[model samples]
Target chain A: MTSDRLAPQRVPIALGDRSYEILIGSGLLSLDGAWAGLPASADALIVTNTTVAPLYGAALAERLQARHRRVLTVALPDGEVHKDWTTLNRIFDALLEAGCDRKTVLYALGGGVVGDMTGFAAACYMRGVPFVQLPTTLLAQVDSSVGGKTAINHPLGKNMIGAFYQPARVLCDLDLLSTLPRRELSAGLAEIIKYGPIADPAFLDWLEASLDDLLALDVAALSHAVRRSCEIKAWVVGQDEREAGLRAILNFGHTFGHAIEAGLGYGAWLHGEAVGCGMVLAAELSARLGLIDRALVDRLRALIARAGLPVQAPRLGIHRWLELMRVDKKAEGGEIRFVLLDGLGRATMRPAPDALVAEAIEAHTAPS
Target chain B: MTSDRLAPQRVPIALGDRSYEILIGSGLLSLDGAWAGLPASADALIVTNTTVAPLYGAALAERLQARHRRVLTVALPDGEVHKDWTTLNRIFDALLEAGCDRKTVLYALGGGVVGDMTGFAAACYMRGVPFVQLPTTLLAQVDSSVGGKTAINHPLGKNMIGAFYQPARVLCDLDLLSTLPRRELSAGLAEIIKYGPIADPAFLDWLEASLDDLLALDVAALSHAVRRSCEIKAWVVGQDEREAGLRAILNFGHTFGHAIEAGLGYGAWLHGEAVGCGMVLAAELSARLGLIDRALVDRLRALIARAGLPVQAPRLGIHRWLELMRVDKKAEGGEIRFVLLDGLGRATMRPAPDALVAEAIEAHTAPS
Candidate 1:
């Protein structure tokens, strides 16, 4: 008797001794085999948020219960802003109260907020516990859920506090995205578009052609996009798991993007939205430096616009942008490193002159 | 011209990919070349405590300034209870205000409290940044400094929040021990005694003979003890960087010791004080189970007593002990796994019978 259930794809992040796998696909959340890799007889803690609990908490409990004798769930307020120490303590309290052990596996079951917070909690719980990611948003599915970058944002900077903790398994269910709002969908597409330019030009061209289909919630288009993005992320992470060298390329538009996010106040702009606009600015910067033609920059901006994402920065005022960007992680000793594109698929980290960066910011923020 | 400075010993941890070196000796705090392995052009943030800043902070700052163009330091309150999110944010604030970037390196300059907090802060700063350990206390230099177990205490449990973040370099300066109080000296020796049973039997025998000399501040005896303990810890951490198996051996006395610390309230008992008493109880429990001869337990207790360490539990009451132990990381599904000695130089994890554990607790708390 053969079953028709699709097998989960496990993408191994090779950090040598510190390496782990990212388990991708739908319905894996309900599999006991997923918990088999964890310590035997260990207690399990499901960390979800208010928005995710109503949607999938019961089902997750049922799945974990089949393998583990005891299980507990803690749900926190859902939002990027809530991913701070205050919200993180709720998990600490629940684990301490429930007598959760070092071997306890913390299952993160939400978007980037839940995943990052859960990962940080796991990193700190008992000085670290076994944790698995059950990411439930399109943006998390394609990006945040794969890498080991777990953090809580500080008021001064985005993701200013966190750890490079690799999850034992990252269970990404594509079906969960069916409930995501339209704006979130567009925001997620920004990351999906990102993978193409930094790693695969062909993927970028395919994304441009299938932008409408993906926006319409076409399953095949979405799956392909998610798979390709994960593959690129896995390969990059495998080579530079700790963000040493090659990994900087993966942050193609993130330098400017993080600055934008911090300038707007976290949660004001979705991570992907900031990244989308940042990618356009990077392209313009690349053109100004004569690395890529100005026509290519227009093409990149047009694709971003067609996908319903902002191709320009919001009116944050240039001074605020410079102040925010100066604290960005990508900046080094007063020099801002921009991940500028060499062509459609290739990118490099270049030190942009302050005057040119200011000019790009001015152009992008101008009306129309 | 030949300088009179002695070269620091680099103890190599042998795990193939996750291998690291532990530098031991005095004056390592003044070596900027110690940070050569970290990413280039990275800004640095030094996380310390109030007590250590006045002692070694200026010297460390001068050395770091010679290496990195920008270096910032944040001094936190000294104590175990303050090793929480509130204190962690102080470092985050300095990093943000100093405009620290992702590649920033954090230097932990103090005792165990400062090292653990600094390593944890580095683990969370920008999702992760490289950190170096400049352990300035006998307890830190001999024990906490070598291992990567970084954490903060939760109200409900000690070390309930933390991470296993490794440092790029560990500089354990023996000269710093000159300033450590005599009470703290005995507290640090408890961890030194721990190394013998778990990994080195000869070391245990040697420690028993040299206990008085070590207490008398015999430099040769103390240096040998510190070096051996670091070698064992580094080996275990190297073998199981994530505590999969071999690394758990390092926690032989920690499972029970942590409970005692939390039961009495964090900071109420010095970590080594609790561990010294916990090891005696663990040996007794082992003897009760026929895992070791009664003479082994008696010898262990005698050695602890000679070192001026507690061999009995404080008056926390049995009910509180049970409650705190239940929340221990070694616990799984209400069954606590105690690390008991099989012999004078061997330890193993087993689920202790409640009756035996209760009896042991009763005996430890008896008036005598």
Candidate 2:
């Protein structure tokens, strides 16, 4: 249990027939042995970004080629800005060009953006096909890669166009995070910290203790963080696979987070960074609603600031924030819905009154 | 059932939670009563093509407006050529432009092209939303609008990029097909002829007997055909929704049909036209495999020809036909698979040897 170098840990996502595992550890890309008996498709396509392909493209393809009759790779342009329909169609172009059939299995080999677009491509490719997530970035391994929410960004809203398409399996290689930038590493921590306020307070405390090791790229810390996050996500999704009810709790800060991303434009702030600030805003809103105390908000803000994520949100203004938040997919009947903490480690969905929403936005916005 | 005008007949597609009904009758659209309690979304969006919108847009909007808080319309350019990412995104653009939320319900109001694009749009819009199929064309009412297989075409293939998303309800108003052009009526008949070879031999006999009445757009004939086709489709999809096993039978001629559509360019021939010709090719292939006799092939050819669908297929060279069909989503392990008839009524999927496929193609091509 203590030894962590290259030892793969499997976390099963219990989704009945759609269930698969999240394999977390080091050197998973080169471990051809794990590739056995899982999705024995004759054809395989690996979708990655420009930054990731050159690093491990050949090795990944080589591993897949050992078992598959054919392996094709499509490297997309990097970053959140490219998560649009045009860029998404490029993967479709490659799949169609390769004459890959429905039996073809897609491997998404980058961060959340890559995993999302590839999962979506698999979902729509011939109506439905199987895909695996080889999420390289920590943000993906902990959050996006675990859940089946695959989407490309719409001009008006982030992730506004997508589907809840589950992957065949998820392989989270801890070694991949070694080369991730410090800023991205902190970004991933935002997601790790989110699990605490909404579902598990104990996980939040462990994250506080291990943030330093995770930021330093310690394999055990990274592995534990990814595995625990996936376990929580799997449990949540298993109960409500389609965000029917319980699943919305997992999107604790996502409503505010999505507004920020859409407001400032997608790439201006990293997704996890927006969510970090978003969680603070949600906590503030919770405090305003008399659900959680100010102390909890203060503690959350402190942990976020300490983790190198932004504690204060951007000044999108009350009106603009209201407008952008209304565009959220979670919103219904012109009412902006939010997932707020009932108390530390528990969440509930409710539509905040317009006045209170404005007040919360004002409280979160930094003085400029 | 006896009284023809405005007598509503419902065909329930039992898909567990995602299940919905297909309401077939005359004046179903204008009957505001039928629209009630369906998709009770605050926001309703009607996605129709330029051609069909002018005919019934105002009436449809009026019916939806009575129930919905807000009603919006996005009219795409008509035709199979427009059923791609560009046209599909126009719906998204309007959805975002209107600040429509997740609870918004979309109404697909046109042929298979419109129904398919709208369904896919509904599937991906905010990860999913409720949608109703108000199919105007015969092809859509009989086939595409029922099964929940929604897709947009890629440059390389028809229905290449899509999803398996069901609609909240399907309203096939027999009146909508009255104004349908003769060519499109024949196109719709292609899908009707498909049900016989795959599941129901009696439905085939009935279709053959009433071909003239259907071609003439008789209200009773149209109503019966739409209901029977949907009933067959519903039964098949209920057994196998995602084309895992039993659902493949629904794609009787689609493997070859898709190649025809892809090879000639998506809009060059109507989808039904391709399927009509493809059915002939499949029957010939079926005879080659000894799964069905020459009499059955001749019977299918006569019915397809009398229904005004193409009995002769395009002379795609053996190399080209092989290349194209291999790209079909149905193909597996580099082998071209076909849904061949086990007898007059039952269908089974198997890979026909390449030589037999080539020979069948040669047999079906015109003498010239």
The most accurate candidate by DockQ is: 2
Q: Give the Cα lDDT of each candidate.
A: 0.79, 0.87
lDDT by residue for model 2 (A1-368), tens: 22356668889887768878888888777776556558887889999999999888888899888879999999999988899989999988888888887888999999988999999889999988899998888888898766799999987877899999889888888887877888998888898888889889999889888877877788888888888888888888888787789988888888899889889987788888999999998999999999999999999999999889987789888888999888676776578889999998999999888898888878878788
Worst 10 residues of 1 chain B by lDDT: B1-10
Among all windows of ten consecutive residues in candidate 1 chain A, which has the lowest summed lDDT?
Answer: A1-10
DockQ (Cα-based) for each candidate? 0.73, 0.80
Give each prediction's root-mean-square deviation over alpha carbons.
Answer: 4.4, 3.7
What TM-score goes with each of the models?
0.86, 0.89
The residue-by-residue lDDT of candidate 1 on B19-109, one tens digit each, is 5677776556666555557555557777888898898788888878877888788899988768877887888888888777777888888
The segments of candidate 1 whose C-alpha lies over 4 angstroms from its true place after superposition are A1-42, A253-269, A312-327, A352-368, B1-10, B16-18, B26-44, B62-65, B68-71, B197-201, B244-269, B284-298, B311-338, B350-368
Error of 1 at B366 (Å): 7.0
- Candidate that scores best on lDDT: 2
Model 2: what TM-score for its first chain?
A: 0.93
